[model samples]
Target chain A: MLLSRMVPTGFNDLRREMDRLFQDWMPGDGNFFRPSVFPAVNVWESGDTLYAEAEIPGVTMEDIEVSVVGDELSIKGTRKPMPEGDYTFHRQERGTGEFCRFVTLPMPVNAEKVEAVLKDGVLSITLPKAEEAKPKKINVRTS
Target chain B: MTTATAVEKREGKVRPEPTRGGRIYSPNVDILENREELLLLADVPGARPEDINIQYENGELTIHARVDSRTEVGEAQFLACEYGVGDFHRSFQLGESIDNSKIHAKVKDGVLTVHLPKTEAVKPRKIAVKTA
Candidate 1:
């Protein structure tokens, strides 16, 4: 099923870029951020840690990988297509493709200490902060 | 003026139905309040909290859920499905009203929760007025 989309600000830049890159090639209409096909992910932050979650329902621990470089974070994985068998056609809307999305974190993350857990088709990652980046209290000066 | 004629008219006027099987449904969700933060709860059956995702890009919050065990096949002998494996998405609009500096989230079992505390200058507070 096609998700509804209303143009956002400066959408013309996107059209220009598409045309500049594909002017000589077949103008593909459906090549973009198709949310339905790939798993959904969420990211949040606390005092010192940055958290990221990804949905890969049918995959196992081996299917997911997470890594952080400086303030840039990358999450990539493969979602295998459904197997062929005795399944009469009704609807096939879910996406099956290799997906890689790069996201930036608000604070520098501890790439060495990043922890990832995969359960129930979801992958959760915790990126702890370097000690110096965490919040610190300053003592009041009475002078 | 006849039953056959009425049925024909109805069929001719009704629009052709679209396929209904290509959907993903996460269960009812709840976001609760806490002393220090707020909680976001979403029920995703056959899903692991580890496999769920929550992200804050600028002020936009996006939630995605994926389950690997349940899948939909094209043909079926006997099929009854309440939920099938596919991608699920939900998002929110955020402004300076939230503490972009201190937001947290966690998922346990199949429920996903996000804790967004009000900024220090903005959190709920009570004031007292002296008797005039």
Candidate 2:
């Protein structure tokens, strides 16, 4: 399988260099900093509840930790590397290390009713909105 | 300018189909070569075992998977959406040394593994020394 990408030349190379320059300054944990965005995540709202899903393949359920305080949701986990031995790698695109993603909900959510499930290497969390946070529709009367 | 045009042409010509018009994503993969076979491991999160599709034809290998919906539309409120839910699609061209018939695949915890065994003709053989 072909893994390495072709080296860009000319103008494309200039853009590539610019990208590298910006990526190096992004927020990171210093010693373990990587140029990737890490495990991808998505957050949306449904009815009175807010849902968040994150792709965290190769991580076991025990390795993950989820916490919610008011509107802030935090997910922490580590993806362990495969066993080491006598093997030559043809392609290595998957990342393995510790990762933490913190997301602040748009609205206040009840922390007591939050539920999280890890299935098929994806973590899904459901946070119900507090009683006062739900939208209230007012009826209009014309005289 | 030239490279940009070439990229656009490639994308236009080779587009992978996504279910329900969902975006196309590429899952991370690791390919390792052993003594007898090559093992491929792909991280296809949110995809069930039944949703994964693997195909091999004309020395090319392709993998596709459908991601489940995270939230219902319109009913929910807008929030942070850094990542998207889409069907994963990736393809790789293989050489003639690989034995396609013996290839096997398995999925667990959203990770798919494909084993490609080397053909007997290409495997290393130990020659016996002759004593005169």
Candidate 3:
């Protein structure tokens, strides 16, 4: 009875809405049950650089993968479940599975200059914008 | 307290209580019992090792973890937010068979593991069978 109630009633509804949004934004069936993004990430941009951080607990640096292709940055990793044993679980809310998140950068970035780091199970990525992509100020000349 | 009535007592003390002013979220955890000890595994993502606190008193074991706030990046805007960060709090009742003084805790990769050892007298022991 407790387990049944623990499942949020609005979860499926939110999943459906997210599926629709993902379908229009990216090409795919947008399966909501098995989401493409796990270990939710935050992405933001500055003047000449973009930053992305992902919360991935129980994952090592070796398992985390970060790459920049064109204006898109992708983060991929897997969270393996606990070891098999004869232990009874009291409460298990965390899900374990492979996840990949693809984010489109707002500005063009230099892929070669991208830096990624994983510390305390959180992955941070920095992408520097290409020289030509940086905003330039133009001064008007008075004749 | 081994009967069905004991269940009510356990549930009564497990209610979530907010700490101070910030929002308090219950951390996901797994409890395992063996012949020697009870192991508690909790998922407290984004919490630094130094921020986790464990306390035991009067047969009650509690965990308090303060997750560090997100790093501040200048002019950064969140595009999508699926997980909200907050402090974690949870408490469990330990029976008399447990040795509270020997409990140990450690955090790694954002996971906290607590070990609660059973008292020597409470451990299962083999009794000799003899013909009278």
Candidate 4:
């Protein structure tokens, strides 16, 4: 079947047209509203460890690199392009390319203890708080 | 300049049926068509393979994936909350007829691929010209 003939001109097409217009008007990269960062990240802290998560579908562990230096965490990866063939695209939305994101942690972390895991296309990093950065309990005595 | 903006978040349509209690997101997808079949690829991170459900009925294909909460809200203090963790739901209306028995799907690295083969009647045929 000629599936491309059945492609619908829906809201997504309209949105794409609007984006193209805005991009054409601003060719010098001077626009005030920048696009959102890639690999949108979510970070949280629990107990003495901080966690960061990113959704990176279709990315393999071999192509991903995670590192922590002092208070900065960096994630870098590349998504390979689909194999070339005789297929015709009806709708293209997912992106494929190299992406890198750097996030500054709120507190100093033990870089030696940082751990990262990739599961089900989600990357989760655990950063343990540095000894000096952790909250300490002070002793109370009767005066 | 290698960095590109992530896919925009589109909330899934609210369904009348009861849910397991979490926001519903519409996963980004790409559709491709060849002479043999139509291919659909959807990005659904954090969803287990067994939790995905696909249905084709009335010239419409629907995809739903249930995702378990990764972290408890009361336990962790969010420092930067940019994306939500929840289930995914999306549906597409198909205008061409497909061979129901030949349809198949697979998931790997959080991406789901569904292949819908066209019926024999719709497949393109080549005719030869001969001299009389």
Best by DockQ: 4
Residue-level lDDT tens digits of model 3 in A111-130: 99999987766677888989
Q: What is the TM-score, restricted to chain A, for candidate 1?
A: 0.69
Chain A TM-scores in order: 0.69, 0.70, 0.70, 0.77
Report the lDDT tens digits of candidate 4 across residue range A1-143: 00001111243345445656786676653222323466888899999999999888889999999998889999999877664667777666577888888999999999999999999999999899999999999999999
CA RMSD, predictions in order: 24.5, 7.4, 7.6, 7.6
lDDT of 1 by residue, B2-89 (tens): 2123222322122212234334442334444433444444545445556677776655555766655332233222111212344445
Model 3 TM-score, all chains together: 0.74
Report clash pairs, candidate 3.
Answer: none
RMSD of 2: 7.4
**Model 4 alpha-carbon drift over 4 Å, by segment:** A1-35, B1-18, B130-132
Query: Can you list each candidate's DockQ?
Result: 0.03, 0.40, 0.32, 0.42
Candidate 3, superposed: residue stretches over 4 Å from native? A1-37, A83-86, B1-21, B126-132
In candidate 1 the C-alpha lDDT for residue A72 amounts to 79
List, residue by residue over B1-132, the lDDT tens digit for candidate 2. Answer: 222233223321234654476566666678787768767888777788789889877656778887766677678665665556667777666555678889999887778888888789877788999998
Superposed by TM-score, candidate 2 places the C-alpha of residue A76 at a distance from the truth, in angstroms, of 0.5
Docking class of 1: incorrect
lDDT sort, best first: 4, 2, 3, 1
Cα lDDT of candidate 1 equals: 0.51
Tell me the deviation in Å of residue A4 in model 3.
18
Report the TM-score of the second chain of model 4 against its true counterpart. 0.84
Score each candidate by Cα lDDT: 0.51, 0.70, 0.69, 0.75
lDDT of 4 by residue, B1-132 (tens): 000111122212224253677676667788777878878898888888899999877656788888888997698999997777877777776644678788899988888999989888877888898999
By the TM-score metric, which is better: model 2 or model 3?
2
